[model samples]
Target: MTRVYTLVNQKGGVGKTTSAINLGAYLGVYGQRVLLVDLDPQANATSCLGIDKRSVRTGMYEVLIGAAPASPHILHNPRYKLSLLPSSPALAGAEVELIEVEHRETRLRDALAPVMDRYDYILIDCPPSLNILTVNGLVSALNGVLVPVQCEYLALEGLGQLTQTIQRVQKSLYRDLKLRGVILTMYDSRTRLSSDVVAEVRKYFPGQVFDSLIPRSVRLAEAPSYGQPISTYAPESHAAQAYDALAREVLVQDGIPTPAFETTR
Candidate 1:
């Protein structure tokens, strides 16, 4: 079965694109065929994987509007051996255009159906806001949702609204939609606040938080500028190791076998 997850959080700057890119790369390293769907109009995930948004004439926007096929729009990342359905700035306008389209919410679900069987995992990097595009991403998620929450003072600020949106989607669209797990990102062990935030989130969600917490690293912040995932940009960095562990945990949770390898870190 293909495990499709939407990396989403209504709050911006929470490491959603970073987690989606690196996690998909690590999953590919662990012998899983992964396809990352860049659903955000910002196209950060597409650029992070070495694709220039300006050069991408056909992308998720075209597929969603029925102007192009999803397969032809997918670009392969040689570094991670993972495929990507790139996003462009034009996707920002899709919200208004899709409003009048029939079955707009499930457009992405229908677009991805033909390609679902081609990979073991399909990860969607959603936009920061909950709009038609984000709803499409959520509707296409077959496994569940993976939220990347930053360790900061306002960590739980907009979480209530996000949960309410998920519940509404589950009630109306996807009944099997679930909260897969919460990944704590940009954590600094040196800061006492990081620990406090983690504890509070764990207390709120209990068993839903992931064991692999992503640490704050300069390399992680730099990788996207060079259009590469942390695994390829700085494999020896702690961020790379953390994402690798996250991939293992995801596989284990899904009853999939993890590849055994000695860690260089």
Candidate 2:
């Protein structure tokens, strides 16, 4: 079965895009067919994986507005064994363009339907705000939502607002929409603040929180500059280990087996 999940947090710098890229990369490393949809207009996910967003003329924007087909817009990265539905700055205007379209909220779902069965996991990396684009992501999330919460003071507040948004989406948009899990990101074990934030988040989400916590690492931050996932940039690093573990947890949740495998360069 194909599992579709949207990584949403509304608040930026919470490792939402990083989680999407790294987690999806790890899933691919584990022998699963993975497709990462870069729904953010910023196109961080696209650039993070080494695709130049500046040159992407027709991508997710065209797919959403019915200007192009989803499959052809997909860019494959053999390095990570991942496929990306690249996004561009053009996607910034997609919301306004889609407003007049019928069933705007389901545009993503509709566009992704034909290719849904082509991959084992389709992870949508939503923008940092709750806009029409995010709404489309929420409605298209057939599996559920995966929120990456930063380990900081205001983490709870942001999560609460996102939960409310999820509730609203559940009631009005997609009833099957539910929180798949909360990923604790940017964790600094040396700081008491990070510890407290993790405890509080786990307390609130309880069983919905994943055990693998992503640490604040310099290497993780620099991976995107080189346009590679942490798994390929620093496979032996803590950040990679954490995301790999998180990917395993996600696979387990989906009743998939995680076999011991190594990436070939």
Candidate 3:
């Protein structure tokens, strides 16, 4: 069975896209047949993978609106078993068109039905909002991981709205949807404020938090612009190693063995 995981957060520049790209890449490097679905219309994930958005003909937008099939849109990367269902800016229109459709939340669910058994994992990189497209992603997710809390001043504020959305989805729709865990990102270990934010998150999330903390690094911020995941672009960077560790933890939590930690970075 394919474990569908959504990397979602309402915050921007919190390393959400970075985590999605590298985690999916390394999971493929670890021998899992992974399919990365970029649900973000920004196409950052697609670009980070070296796939030009302009050349992408069929993507998540077409599939969700019943304009394309699931298989043809898959872009295979030469370096690994990972394939991608890239997204385009057109996906932003889904939020509005979905209003008049029956079972709008189920559109993505139905589109993914046939391909569920073909991969070991399906990673959905959601956009930075709790809109219909995200709802569609949430409806189809088995579990979700959030990249959050870059500081302490406004630690985990406005999270109630997101949790409420998830709770409501579980109550009346996808009862099986689960909050997999939270990974703290962009922590400047030199700051006491970073420490306070982690403490605050742990109080509410408890054992659900990942033990690995992602430090803010220039290498991470620059990797995407070069059209490469941190694992491939700056393999010796701390951010790369952090994501590799994260990939290992995700595997371990799923009852799969953790891969060897990379030390070069």
Of models 1 and 2, which has the larger TM-score? Answer: 1
* Candidates 1 and 3, the one with greater lDDT: 1
Q: Which parts of model 3 are misplaced by more than 4 Å? A: 145-147, 259-265
Q: Over all chains combined, what TM-score does candidate 3 have?
A: 0.93
Candidate 1 per-residue lDDT over residues 51-155, each given as its tens digit: 889999999999999999899888886668799999999998899999899999999999999999999999999999999998998998898999999999989
Model 1 regions more than 4 Å off: 261-265
- For model 2, how does the per-residue alpha-carbon lDDT over 1-265 read when each residue is reduced to its tens digit? 9999999989888998999999999999988999999999999999998788999988999999999989877888887899999999999999899889999989999999999889999999999999999999999999999999999988888667788889999999899898999999999999999999989998998899999999999999999999999998999998999999999889888888776523311
lDDT of each: 0.92, 0.92, 0.80
Report the Cα lDDT for candidate 3: 0.80
Output candidate 2 Cα RMSD: 2.5
Give one digit per residue, the lDDT tens place, for model 3 in 176-223: 887887878888889999999899898988898888788888898888
Higher-TM-score candidate of 1 and 3: 1
Indicate the worst ten consecutive residues by lDDT in candidate 2: 256-265
Candidate 1's displacement at residue 260, Å, is: 1.8
